[model samples]
Target: MAILKHFAVKNADYGAVIDYLKYQHDEFHLVPILDENGNSMLRDEFYFDGLNCNPEAFDLECELLNQQYHKNQRYDEIKCHHYIISHDPMDVADHGLTGEQAQAIGMEYAKANFPGHQALVCTHTDGSNNSGNIHTHIIINSLRKEDIASQLYTERAIDCKAGYKHHLTKEYLRHLQGSLMDICQREGLYQVDLLSPAAEKITQQEYHAQRRGQLNLDMANMEIMAEGIAPMKTKFETNKEKIRNAINDIAERAKSFEEFQRLLKAEYGIQVKDHRGRFSYLPSDRQKFISARKLGSHYDREYLLQLFEENALAAEQNQAQWVQDDPITILFIKSDLRLVVDLQNCIKAQQSRAYAQKVKISNLQQMAKTVAYIQEHGYDTQEKLQDTTDTIQSKMAKARSDAKLTEAKLKRVNEQIHYLGQYLSTKSVYADFLKSTNKKDSRQNHADEIAKYEEALQFLKQHSPDGKLPTMNDLRSEKELLVQQKSAQYETYQYFRDYHRELQTVCENVNHILDISQPKQQEQKRLHQSEHSL
Candidate 1:
């Protein structure tokens, strides 16, 4: 049985969120600590954050908090948190917990999950009828206020790297499901996926169809056509305009329709047809003369039409082949991939800083230990050692600060990677599905579908994938650069490891004062050398 499933956080004003929730459900009940007249004589702490606080007692406290903060300005600036710990109520009922009991269990789960986290927890009964699941809201003041030196709402130094305790990522939520599933086993609730799947499951066509309606396939074909045609760009409007301009240019010289048709067939190789028998515009002899003069040979009408249609279909077919190649490839090609670039850059920058910090910190620890040894154990070469120690300590402090900054960057990069992975995963699945399937439709419908997909692909090419457009070659080159960067990082890590170990050994020897060591100085020298190598 799986237990945990989906988790999300939204930043919003507390009051607005509460109001929305209140309005969204009529039967939704809110119990407060205070009476209707706003008096709080009752203070109960049976359950923290809504779990097992006696329902009667929970209601009282809720009322009290509401009365206490309804008019407070702080409520307007906080975010309301909500989550669900779902188990099949029917399954639980079979095990001994009734529907109300299951709802209570979920409420308790929510409450126990985030105690002392400055949050409000509540359970719902009619969750399934409302939204196919039972859940709880952990409404907390995004901005917390406490009398102690450390308060919940105070903005602490956020190492976004470390994430939050009560709040977590989609991945964390899935992990949390494990705990919930255990609870279900203990309480005899039906178990299911603890966290929702980390990736999206949408197919490419489905995803495109979400935004494009019925035209996704056409738009896709158009993109393929554009890819196939080397010299011509892949803009439908541009292509249409070019064709129209050619038509108008030929029309400008024609004194009659016959001459106009002859000019088109000979000069542009276009064959426009009305409901007449296959016929050429000019007299047979005159057309032959024009063909020799303009086209330098016998230009045939049927041959020109065939050539044009073949050219058009060839372009279209190549794009179709592109879509058919591999859905993941298309997804990789079509994503808003600028984030990937930005994240890669950020990670590289952070890794470099962390590497430098590791080296400097090791050197500083060495210097600190040596200085202490000189002061306590011996003073034969004290002054020089002290000077070196101070310098190392300073450098180490700077390194530690830099490392913190790097860690922050790495954390952000990781988060961005998670986001991009989800987006790309969903798109790839759908693209693959679209490429693998075929459908039957009227010829006109099929053509329209093709056109729609072409238009959508064009729009995606222009905008959705992020920043400026990149050529296929550019994508390959960028990947190559990332590979090189990774290699450089690996080298840095190697240097840090060897130097840090030597420094630690030197520092330990100095503490014992056993060998009257020159190792401390030697290690410091090595540290400097390593820095240069990086």
Candidate 2:
């Protein structure tokens, strides 16, 4: 996938942009390396308007633009624009193109799009995530240099003003994405739908928060390791994950709609507001509210309401079961239990097939080894060969049994871990709900909060009928145990699997020797019979 990102530089010093792009800086070290004298030591390529500018003369050209466009309105507004043409790492690798080639593509695109503009195009080989994604930076002055009116006449007359600011519109950006896609396809590079909406889009603020939170968690873990103590959970959870989990818990309950709204406010400190038929959530801690639609399809009004209806129908059909099992356990019984069973069966099938294939391959190789062994060792007696074959067959049978048992244990432990994780996640939301409080408000405010609170309550009842859930510590302990057990089982399974292959090889080798000897013996017997008859 390729992305087109644009940013405006408001700083008066255009030379700063040139220095950052051309020079080796610690902040952006992925670009190119420089020696003690500050000259580039790596293959960092830069181009500007076809031979008029080099890295050394880049600042001079930018300064000339500033000098020519002195009549521009304000120094605070954007003076120049920086556009990035970034390609996917996989695409770059698949295309077998250098960073320079990628930069040239961006440069050509920029020139064609922004004619009569002084621009510096620099291609980079690495991305912020340390992935070797090929990207190009095209920094162009905001000032339009050419007399557009004199050059050409169109439906909309071009501004011939000396210092007209170049406007970037949505249509232009869309065009850039389409153009890049075409270029990628033509080059036979791996491409994705750059213009389509993403499945989940994380906002810049949330992204930064997650990164910061992860860094803090890492530092905390290091400290804990040094102290030989258990680490504590960080309070900084990304809103997206928190909200998604909360919504999932609520959706699963699917009680009355009114109860759903009430519980949302009372439990989670999240006020679900309806605005012109659209549902939005406003967290107590944040002033801004986000649309439910933005969260995902599950959180959409219709989908959530449908879940409530389904829950009601299920309760009516099986009142005894519904009354006996809590919402959480019911959820497990209905979905997770069945899912785990199916997954275990699938894993078993896959393992069986894989084991058979491995054994077959090992047997074939062993047969070849057996021929060589017989030729070298001169094993002429059938009795000695039969003894060796029996021993190998016995070992192969045991190995197969051991491998199967170990794999089954591993699968069970994994399923337990998965179940425990979901249970803990759902429990955490309920814990938050228990801790929340409802305060007095105006009639209208009360009405709004009441609606959300009722809905939330219904959600809780449907998800957790018994109202009693496992503690976080209990869940965590079980999870740790299961994870450890899984690790141990996996090691054992691998060992047995390797041993099984060895046994298969030995068995095949013995069988091959027997096959060769039996054929020779039959031929000898026929020759003996013919001699007796004569």
Candidate 3:
């Protein structure tokens, strides 16, 4: 899977980014020893190019732009936005991806996204764990250097104008992710669901921490082995990994939120608390609690609780057990969600004269509004009103269902497009393998490539049972149609959700009226007493 990551570079030195891309910084940290006949050296398997600027003098060009725009002057101002697209390690073997190709892709992406900004595009094959993954680095000056045309990703007018500093928003990042996915699909590379959270999310910091820790542990293990002793612990695990394991361990077996919490505390020395509708966990070694937001969605409150409810009937049911089980009791105890309110039970309204009068006036006005609404909507009966609410809720739920289905169709189309590209691009390799007399050696040399060809062929064949595989244009056009339909369905879902909320509030108000609005004589006596008291 190709993952897209972002970083905001606030340092004033734009040359440092290019330097990091072009040279090795592992041990010497750019302290270079000149070769006999050369001034400097560049790293192996590294390709770099610039857009709207000279690659050799990116910093100077950016500085000139900054001066012209009068932006990025403050010390704390962000000078550049760094985006990295890391392809899956498997892409190298399966797709025969190269550094040059990745660099070209990065150049195209940067030129399309950051058109007005002076940008440097770099590709590396032997950096960041030496994982044999081809990744690209896209670094763009924060200030716009030209007044370029706007794109669908552009959110504001200033984004396309010169002299304005780049300020990326969440929407822009999501669009970039979508664009990255599209690029990966078109390029016949692996792609992940960037729109959703990962099952196990390791941040860049945590990833590097684990990498360094593992490296150090391997070194220590080597020394121990040199002494003819087997190291007891050869593997290293980060604190977050331990926490995640503990939480998943407890949540997989526990039946309720409380039981899960108790087991988590007793078994792992981890304390879990629901704070302001969210869960926060404190490990034994940490002073502060880490929010579930930092962790992936698999550890969040909604997911865990739902998992527990499903685990409750593990001994009996097979699928969606919670759907059959009643959650009303649990919700009434733990959740603020409710169907109705009891206005008569408000003790504060009964305690004071002025407050009582104010509440009564408000309740009378609400009751009048409720009546007017019921009459206006022709809901003359309680059952009819409730039926209307249920119908609207059902419609909202159906709209959401439609949106999910449409999104899934879009994803399928994306996969079909990817496999179609793979099928077409690898036909020559397959033909050569078939024609080669030394078939065994050829297959052994390109095992992953062979697998890629076979898997893509099988997938396309199955997807197109009629044996008429779709062309790239057909798949892309289908994707475009699905995207438009998905958006329309999402808008419909939003409209229904808003309408449901409005109707639900009216229904709750009607219930409140039912609770507080009493007989005329008794209500008059209560108001008369409150008037005298006031």
- Candidate 3 stretches with Cα past 4 Å from truth are 27-40, 317-534
- Alpha-carbon runs more than 4 Å astray in model 1: 1-13, 16-78, 96-99, 128-133, 143-175, 193-534
Which candidate would rank higher by TM-score, 2 or 3?
Answer: 3
Q: What is the per-residue lDDT of model 1 for residues 1-534, given as tens digits with 9 covering 90 to 100? A: 423433233443344434323333322232333457764332211122333233324334433444454522333432334554544556534665444655556556654444433445544434533543444444543322222233233344331211132335444454456657777777656676534332223332333333343244457667777788433333333222334455557644544445556556544544444323232233212333222112211123443445455656776787678768632222321111110012233555467877656645654555565555445433466354444445445545555555555555455444444434444444444444456545333323355444444454454355423443333333343344444445555544444444344334444444434333467778889999999999
**TM-score sort, best first:** 3, 2, 1
Q: Which ranges of candidate 2 are over 4 A from the true structure?
A: 24-56, 71-75, 147-162, 203-209, 234-267, 276-279, 290-534
Model 1 lDDT at residue 214: 26
Cα-based lDDT at residue 435, candidate 1: 65
Least lDDT summed over 10 consecutive residues: which range in candidate 3?
327-336
lDDT of 2 by residue, 225-322 (tens): 79898777755678776876776776577487766766565445566766786678876567898887677656767667788899888778787675
- Which of the numbered candidates is closest to the native, going by highest TM-score? 3
Quote model 3's TM-score.
0.56
How much lDDT does each candidate structure score?
0.43, 0.61, 0.80
